[model samples]
Target chain A: MKIETLFIDRAIRPCEEIDYIIQSTSLEPEYVENSKVVYDHVNLSDDPITKGKQTLYITENHGAVIKKCPGTSHYTCCDYTILHTGTFCTMDCSYCILQAYFHPPLLQYFVGQHKIDAALDEIFKENKTFRVGTGEFTDSLIWDKISNQPAKLVRKFADQARARSRSSNNNFSILELKTKTVNIDSLKDIDHNRKTVVAWSLNTPKVIKSEERGTASLSARLKAAKECERWGYRVAFHFDPIVIYQGCEEDYKEVIKSIFEGVRVDKNVDSSSDGVIKQSLGILPESIVWISIGTFRFMPQLKQIIENRFPKSTIAYGEFITGLDNKMRYFKPLRIKIYQKIVSFIRQYAPDVLIYFCMEDEEVWQKTIGFFPKKEGQLGAMLDRSVMERCKAC
Target chain B: MLNLQTTISNSALLKKRVKQVCLDAIDLSDESFKISSDNLFFSGNKSSSDNSLSNLTNLSNLALSIRLTGLINPIVLREIDDKYIVVSGFKRVSAMRSIGMRETPASILSHLDFDKDKTYDFRFYEVQSALIAISDNAFSRQLNVMEQARGVRLLKRFCSSYDIAQNSPAIFNVNMGESLINMLDDIANMPLSLHELIESDKLSMSSALKFKQYGYDKSLIESFATLFSKIKCSLSKQKEIITNIHEIAAREEISASDLIESKEISQILDSQSDNCSSNVNDENQKANLIRSILFNRRYPNLFKAKERFSNNLKMLNLNSGMKSDIKLDPPADFEGRDYTITLKFSTVEELAKKANILSALTKNPLFGDITD
Candidate 1:
């Protein structure tokens, strides 16, 4: 959030989107002919990762506008597609893989909106349903104040959904704006037509305070999700990178209870002729489209980064083993235990809500959720089906 | 010109005072000295009492040098109540004794008027004498850890009774900081074998200090010091191994002695000892093997994971082909969820062969285990 310096590529200086972003911030942009200067400056600092959070760069993304998520080989992937708009994020999480993935760790925003629109249009013409998100490399809504990209993307998805509704063939797409921020002001007035799923990454209060820096609180995020739900927008929740610590289960149970309290759910009741009534116990079962749960996992190289950045962190001091994917993870039994507890808590509160495991294998699914996706793309299809059943445009 | 005149006048004045002092002492004649080597006492100097110093490797060379050029510098001694205490020239006297010479030239400074006053403490005289001996040896070459330890040990005694500022010039001359003094005091009380290991540079001073700080039992310290000298390792590895064992013992609520006597550690030490006796050529490799075993014992979960990964790699059976060309790249320490399979080929035939191997490998269940 505290971007100390803004470096604009000479070519992107004339970009209208770049001008809009510059006009909104108090940062005076320093025009650079090449991005290598910014990279060199960041890498030369004493703490490159911390310094990187303070530096911003505006440049063009020459690569594909939409790309497949590079999921690992052994893990089951949901076939999620990413709308590549930038690299690196402003929020500083101790266990974030971006700390080691990017060398200079520069916060780069791509100024290629035309390329993105064309890519989205091509996807809209395709016969298959696409589940696209823009929060992989960066937060989806953190840059809302400057560029208003989320608002534009929501409108674009809404238009595509409306077009599909009129066509004879079935073609649909969902744009999930996943974020840890509560920047919902720009999203309030947009007519999304339920094509945009506003999702918040949820965590316990302890983790948010200790590890997640510069992010909204748990209550604030849920409040924003409640606001979006009231606007006729489909809402989703992601309890990802769930850190396992002492007394974490009770904390997570309370969070689950709060989620149901904040949002509305469908209920059914039956009454006999004697005026007796029996009500079904379900919370947010119909309104909350889906929830994904993924435990804390990291690349081997991230161990050193976490140690250097957060020396007092005990998150890495767990019983871990190298899985087939060659990443350090909690011991199989430990991960299964944590997941089972969380899944049970969720089922107790919202039994009928769509619950899926993000990047988890079939065995884990079988053990925790009592079922697994039949095939590779089965999870994606299930998510698309959930969207169709929940959203308005479908 | 005024500076030059002052220098000449001061030199003359210093000569006149030296002559007067010598006259008052009344022992200017060389015959007054007993030149017999047996008459000289080695007990006065603590460093000379070392048995290792008596058998110095360079004694013969010094003797040969003296035979060719004679002793240019006379051995210095102090007359304490008709007894000559050696203040300097321990090595010279040692070389003379090695050549079986009974008599040698020496200069003796008897108790003078300077020591008559209460301001001139006899303890100060003893400290200054030891300092002179240490400085003489230090100027010729670098004193080894043992000699330095002896010197620092002697100075530490004076440090407690006198102000540091008053005695700092003598202490600091040998680089004796408080920490170094503490280390030397600890080392002086250590067993002779450990002292020899430290003196020979096999064990570092910092590691020795850490061992003391960890409160290792005397027996455990001695056993480890002996084991370390037999096997070779870098200083950091040595420190890490010691510290790791200490920490593991603490975590397990066992004494360090009991931990070192554990079956796993004992087996490793015995096997390495056997390997060492068989004359293993790669010392570092042996050391690494020992360290790996220690680390595995300390972290069992990681050990099991590494074992499983190694077994899984072997299950791939990349060697089934007559010419193996495939490589599996797992993430470092299995800390990430990615694996890469690379096939190497130099010719079209090799490429075809690799493709066939890959097709066969894809059918195996282990392939799924590696890449879902």
Candidate 2:
């Protein structure tokens, strides 16, 4: 995210990291005592949500630097760990929960390498399994220019014994940097050690143009994923917040076709040629670790914000009713039909992809993919096994 | 920085002898006495436009009061060169004018709060007079939302919105948030028909602001105001209808005004009208019909799914309301796997019997079709 103005907390000690961000964005620093100053500053604007994206607040995270994923109740959680590095993103999608997630949404970049390293030390020191990612609350690569945390995280995970009183390879942790942007230049030369999986959120080209504002194109994101794989970093793809419209099923079918064509398949798969899947799979290295699909769902309060901010957007007008988790989700049959099509499309191309649903429940899993995560193992345990097997993590 | 009330009271203006003046000398068109908008009457909603800028409202009662005794409270006024302006008692003057009593006992303030000649303190006195006008009605009765909004519009000129929000209840008879100051301002600046919708509780603050952001033509707002005034729905219902209409219009690439004023919708609305020969007397039923139309237009398949689910639910006769003591509930919105069965029994034997009955229901294929 190229911030137009940088707001620094006055209590924050000046560091080279903060200086680098200010210099990179070419925005003069305005220090404030606390958040009220930033709140009042944005509250004065005609559009606070849009203005917040342009202004970046460089502040310290006084709370836990690493938190568990805030998975809603009554939904299957993937037992993911959240690297609470930041709070909001610059990309403007109509279906973004962050718009209602944050009260008066602001682009907050918590800057302190020591604190982040300290948080990671706990995970690295503990002899436990973790499937951690930074894309839970914000886009991971939106700040590759201003911050090299993703690259630094790659280095930290590679050197597994950096921070530990008890060193054991049994403690497995993979850092996933998921983004809608193609800001992977700094990550090119790093020795990721298969410890980092660079993932891109995939959507149709039509959605990318109309709804995903200021985001990389679908082709660009796929190209970046290929480059990340070329740089020896395992990659993943998420078709999260898949908006449903008239032609969305066919559009998503094309996207699935592009992903399987753009990325190489598993090495052990028979070089089968079903006219559509007849890509060169023999010489290329396998890159995809997993693919997650979650149809669009949001909190009810986001409806008004979307209506006001994205007046032209019709995504919120879907056949939605309150779910058990109290979120506005597409009707069950509607979600099941779409999920069935998407899962079938993915299975046709790469049967070994280890496809998973992001937040759907057991019944949906049974109807869509014919297997429930609970019946196999817990969803988290399943993901933990997949990540560990693919990345060779403990 | 003069205290306006103290200035009016201590000044010799009220102490001077009250006199009757020609009503023609007063400029009734000057809206200095009204915190309410003058032209807030939407075209088709004349039946319920009780506050249609008519200072002559409830004239018979005021005239009866005047006829019984006399002008017990002399109407407060201020002179403007050759003419006068009713500062506080607009209805009284209009009543007297209607009753053919060309003049009444009046307290003409030579030291005017609302001065005809603009002076250095002209804007300050206008603010004072606007507050006085709002306080007059607000103290007697609850000022409706639009009047309160118009009061905000009037007082916003002299103070910060923070001050208005902090001191709104005493002046406008309604509590307001500092954030809603913009909506209040919109109420003042919006067209008269939209104002009428708000005053009559047809449109809501949130919905009005949505239309304001749409920047659509005034006719669309007018059409919704007209429809809502006729239907007289709740604030939340108004929001839902407007939001659905906009979404459908946007998706179909049709003008929202044309969609609202379409022949089908008009026929549905006219179905419940007094003049129409149709027997549809309930506006709420008409509201449901409109909602169903929009629902079907938006998602034909989902509507069919809801219908199928409803039909399947009807097949299960184990509902507690009809002879049975069991309550079966699908998961909220039918989006999850678990279905709940509640058995209400006062005795253990009854519980066992209900349990056995519930067990018997397990074999019913229609019980499973609700999930399907």
Candidate 3:
């Protein structure tokens, strides 16, 4: 991530997070009364979407520290809880909902920890199982360019999991720190208690090149996942916003192959191998806790946003129809065909890997994966079971 | 009271401020100051423009009036390199020229008056001339969207985009923004056929941009203009037709012009003309049929799905006796699973009858899959 301009909110200026951000970046801090000032500054630029990434707003997290994912309940959601540490990402993606999600998107990180800690403490106190993640709104590791925020979160999740390890029931909390960056140095040697699932959002190489600008390359993300797994953390991968294009089936299949080949052999590989060379040390497939899949979908308003911001992008011009949830989705049979192909390829390597769809319908699940997780909150239960069996804390 | 005061004050101020006084009037009695019919005119080296212009409407009436009344309103001209360019009265000049009048009385911009040229701000004079031309037309009648767009384009040479943003609503009565400004610029520069179509209210501004963006040839655009001039369609419908054709052309790996010339569209036009060339009733029908044909070609999958749904629905044969009380509507586009069933029964006896009918209908073989 590149940090060219830094803004410190007056509400958070006296905090320690500001000191850390100032020391990490050489740019002089431009203190503002609120986020609107930074948004005004960013929207004045030629390209607010790209300009927003280079500008960072170190504001206070006054909103809800954690909340349900915005995927409407009408669609089949995984019931994942969002640890809202921030609001936007530095990465510029052509199909990114955040571009239209925020009212003039900016790189805003919520500083201070009491609100999130209080929210997580309540979650940990519950007897029910919960899946929590910080990557919902922003990439988990993007802040590592200037702050060790992910490590701080890992410590909190790990301590809670360790304290609750004695429980006999299958009740646990799993913190999934998902990212598309290779900033995993702070995560190493953090006593994570095998409770934090460090995950990566994977895509085809063509998609990464043409759509996801400034994100880590496929091999680099997989290598980072391998390193995180080697450091005793459960790793996960998300094949989300899977763009459909010519030869994308082959491209995504290659991504699935590269993912397994990069980290999911028989736990034996040379430490610095370029994927081919091997030794008696490698990451195991068991290190993968779960993988989530979702085809590219967007609100109708986002199409115009993408067209205006990324005029070269053709992602919105698919054989799309309004889905039940009113977001534009690929025609049903088309989504089924692509989903079946991608799932079969993923199963070729890690057959036992717990793969789930993010916001798919029951018909889609039945047609693509041969089962529907629709009855009695079955999808969330299935994910909770996956978390319990992988994390020793439950 | 304050609001009324503000409105009155703003109106008076606007009226006072817009009284442009930079003109150096020439005596019409002096033939030395007047330019003849042979003088050349261009839109000021193409830097300034009177764009989005077409043939003057009601030219015959104006010519008749000129023949009868003898050019009551003298034209105004500006000197340029021994030739003359029109400053105002564009329509009057065009009407006179159309009537083959070899000469006309006119006033020259006193370029020799030097009071208007003290600073030599050539850009200023060009803008002043364009503004005068626009105001003269606007004072008599409301300028159409095209004329407003042209005025903006011409003034933009002297005014910044910010100037347009600040003053456009007052000057042209059109809200100006970056995207709208660029779109209007494109509209101002569109080919004359598309311009005529928009100005005649046959086509719309959005449809004009669609044609311009596709880079369709003059023949194709003129085909649409001619079609629209006869068959009136809404702006959105016109846009839809052009957009679908554009997509279909790309999918077929052919140019849009080729698609317009293809037998599919040409046959539609030909069939309509063959039916009745002058029937007003056929115009809208022709438009709807053409729109449907283009829509069916553009969305093959959706269209096929709709057809399948319709065929399945027809299988119900609901036109049977006593089943007239029942109506079934499938989910739109077959994109959903919900089916709506309505029963028209007003009393218990009718309800019981409907119940018996519904019972018998459930036993029918096609009832189970009517939603398909």
Candidate 4:
């Protein structure tokens, strides 16, 4: 959160977003003729990754603002779309691919609002159901104090959803703002119309403390989700990069219980029934749309980075093999076993909620959830159906 | 015309400064004067007499160059009252003395330049001489590890006495940085055998430093060096073994030397054949045995569980006429929870054969033991 320096591109003229960001932070402005100065300085430092994290660069997107997710053909992708709002994240997870994916690893935020708007318009014109998220390259809410991108994008999607409803179209669009932060103040007063699903990437308390440096605690994330649900917003949970360690199953089970306890409620139960009556749980189960379970997987290059950066991390020591996508993944049976346990827990609590796998095969689906999507695009359609049904768009 | 004039004037000034500095310190009336090789003494403890200079493998080449060029470059010396001390060119001086040369060309720094005051700091003068020696060799060639270590040792000693920049280790031809200097310091204090291993390039500085830091006994380090030298394992493999062994010893609350002397490790070490017929397979087996033993000791529970699982798997004897057809799901190590048995078959007959094997395996008591 403490940015050491801010490098502004000379080509980027003053705008509301850039001005808001520059004024919100106390980091001295270092106006550069080109963005390469920040990159070269970061790369030449003693610890490039750490130094890069401390530095911030504001530049134009210079490319398509909306791009398809870089999913491999070997795996079953969910047809997720990435809104290229930024790159690099503040919070450090040991198995995070961004550590190796980016060369200099500087925290870069694109200030090309016109480009993003144009891309979104193109997406809306085509208007099939698309799950666009800004959490791929960076956390959606990390720049909450500096920039209003989350609220801006959330309102944009709300307007688009309204337009679609007025036109009586069956197809709907969902803007998913996924993050590890509990910074939901910007989303509090917005009329999202349930088109903006506030999602949190969840992990066990041990991982949250050890590997996910500078992230909101599990309780804090669930609390934020609860608040979002109360604000008439559908909420989602992603247990992605679930690490396997000693007692991880029990830890994850505790996390699941807390999630349901914090957000979902048994609406049929009355609080004043009898002596042993239990209060109706807070947030409605229907408001909770989908939960994705993805085990800890990493690009092959991340192994050495994790070893160097987080030497004490035992996450890489799990039984792993090169997956079809060429990422190091837990052995199939091992992944399936972890998934089955988690799915069983989720099913016990909220059976109607849409549960899907992120970048998994048909076999993993059948083995873990006892059923696989019949064909390609079924997973994406299932997610879209959840959006329309839960958000009352259909 | 201006550039040529500037170059000529700069050259004249440089010659004048060199002559003035030399004359102010010592009598240099005879510029090519010679001093007896025996009269030239090396001031520092790191000399050929201390066996530190024994690794200068290119000394013969230098001697050959001197014999041909007739000592074109004069060795720098410090005139301490009546004694002549060789400050730089220890190798050249030793080479000249070795070839029965009576005298050698030299440049003398008078007592004024290297004076011992009432508050005398011997290390200061030693470091000054070391800098000159390192600079003399900087253009000649790169310094070996031992030379770098010796130079850093002198610089560190001087920096401790004088207020100077103690960060960068890029002195002369050695640029190992400060951390390596610390490693070299630790290496310098290690036992002779460990030093020999490092000097011979059989063991790395990092591994040697780890051994020293972990308090590995001299005999244990020597034994590993000996075994590694025989097997000719790669540096990474050697590092793995050393690291795991150290961890196991620390975890078991025993000395590393004691762990090396354990029955299991000794057996693995002794299994290597010294005969000329020993092939690559034998060496690989030996390395594998050592690694397996170290891993077992490090993770006793996992190893025990794996052993039990393997034995139970053998008890099933679920041989479907081929080894690849039937296998345990999730394999060994219990990294995953599910223990379903998977059998692959191509035809109905093969499936029936696999079913029969599974049926027999189900009856075995060890079938239940496999998951446990």
Give the best candidate by lDDT: 2
* Candidate with better DockQ, 1 vs 3: 3
CA-only RMSD, every prediction: 13.5, 6.2, 7.6, 10.4
Best candidate, TM-score-wise?
Answer: 2
For candidate 2, the per-residue lDDT at A138 reads: 92
Alpha carbon lDDT at A185, candidate 1: 87
Worst 10 residues of 1 chain B by lDDT: B15-24
**Candidate 3 lDDT for residue B147:** 74
Give interface RMSD, every candidate, in order. Answer: 6.5, 2.2, 3.0, 6.9
lDDT (10s digit) by residue, model 2, range A1-394: 3468779999989888888888888878899988998987776798887878888899999898888887776788787889988878888887788877776688988988888887887787767677788898899998786887778888887776333324545656888999998889899887666888888899988888888988987766776677677777788889998888889999999888777666333222222324343233211225678899998888888887887888788878788878888888888888989999998898888777778988888889899989887743388887777777778632
Poorest 10 consecutive residues of model 3 chain B by lDDT? B33-42
TM-score for model 4? 0.69
TM-score of each candidate? 0.59, 0.85, 0.82, 0.69
The models' CA-based lDDT, in order, is 0.71, 0.75, 0.72, 0.70
Please report how far candidate 4 places residue A199 from its true position, in Å.
1.1
lDDT tens string, model 1, B250-348?
Answer: 545577677666775555455644465644444465567667876776666667767876788787777566436688776655544467778778899
Among all candidates shown, the one with the greatest DockQ: 2
Q: Per-residue alpha-carbon lDDT of model 1 for A1-394, expressed as tens digits?
A: 5888888988764867888888877789999998889998799898998888888898999888999989776777888999998878888888888888887787888887788899999999988788899999888998886787789999999999888888974768989999998888899989898899999999998999888988888777877787787788888999998987768899988788878865222121111224444222222567788999988888988976876687556566555567767777876656778899999999987787899988777668888998888687888888888887887663
DockQ-based ranking, best first?
2, 3, 1, 4
Give each prediction's DockQ, rounded to 2 decimals.
0.11, 0.49, 0.24, 0.08
Off by over 4 Å in 3: A14-16, A166-170, A263-285, A348-351, B1-57, B63-73, B80-84, B94-105, B115-118, B173-182, B210-232, B245-298, B319-326, B343-358, B370-372
Q: Candidate 3 - CAPRI tier?
A: acceptable
Runs with alpha carbons beyond 4 Å of true place in candidate 1: A263-283, B1-372
List the candidate numbers ranked by lDDT, top first: 2, 3, 1, 4
